[model samples]
Target: MLYYEDLTTGRRFQTASHTLSEDEIIAFASQFDPQPFHTDPQAAKTSVFDGLAASGWHTSSLTMRLITASELKDVANGLIGMGIRDMRWPRPTRAGDTLRAEVEVLGQKPSTSQPGFGVVQLRWTTLNQHDDIAMQLETSIWVARRPVTTTEPA
Candidate 1:
């Protein structure tokens, strides 16, 4: 299990690909975003995207899933997300687009007020099969520290 001490700045990780399905895209959008570009094909054709696309929130959710499923599955304490920043969807995510996630440890530091815990700043990026970035976000995570051990004097 990875702990705060186990992570290093500039370290990177990647996740498996997830192929988006048209049904899933529309279904997710209908529930959350409900925008024409995401929920209606014909309406999307007239929208700025010019075609059906997935909601930005949906893409962010998928990115989180991929990260947890692969990138941080082995961590000692999964994570407590402090907050997200600089979130952007540069390219629209469309049905049939295969997406994968990448994680980079941008910075880390021990918690000043809390013992046995630390904070890590991470940059997450989701890219398509063509290697174009679909979405990106920077977030801070609370990480646990490894337990201290002491041996009796012999």
Candidate 2:
């Protein structure tokens, strides 16, 4: 399990690909986002996207799923999301678009008020099959530090 001390600045981890199916896209949008561009294929043709596209929220949720399945699962304290910033969807995520994530550790600092805990900043970028960036965000998390161990007298 990775602890705060194990995370290095500029370290990157890649997650497995997730293929966005049309049904999945529509279903997610219908429940959470529910926009014409995301739910109704016929109506989406007249929207700015010009066709069916996944909602940004759906993309973000998928990213969370990928992170949990890939990176966060092994973390000792797991990950406590402090906040998120600079969220942007540069390109539309359309049906059949296979997506993968690259998560980079941007920085880390020990918590001033809490020992054995630290804060980490990470940049997550999701790319499509053609390598176009579909979504990007910066997030902060609180991670537990590795316990200090000392040899016992034998």
Write one digit per residue (lDDT tens) for candidate 1, span 6-72: 7789999899999999999999999999998999999999999999999999999999899989958
Residue 114's lDDT in candidate 2 = 97
Task: Estimate TM-scores for all models.
Answer: 0.97, 0.97
Per-residue CA lDDT of model 2 for 1-154, tens digit only, reads 8999878898998898899999999999999999999999999999999999999999999988888889667878887899999999998999999999989999999999999999999999999999999999999989999999999999
Collision pairs in model 2 = none
All-Cα superposition RMSD per candidate: 0.9, 0.8
- Identify the runs in model 2 with alpha carbons over 4 angstroms from their true place: none
What's the lDDT for candidate 1? 0.93
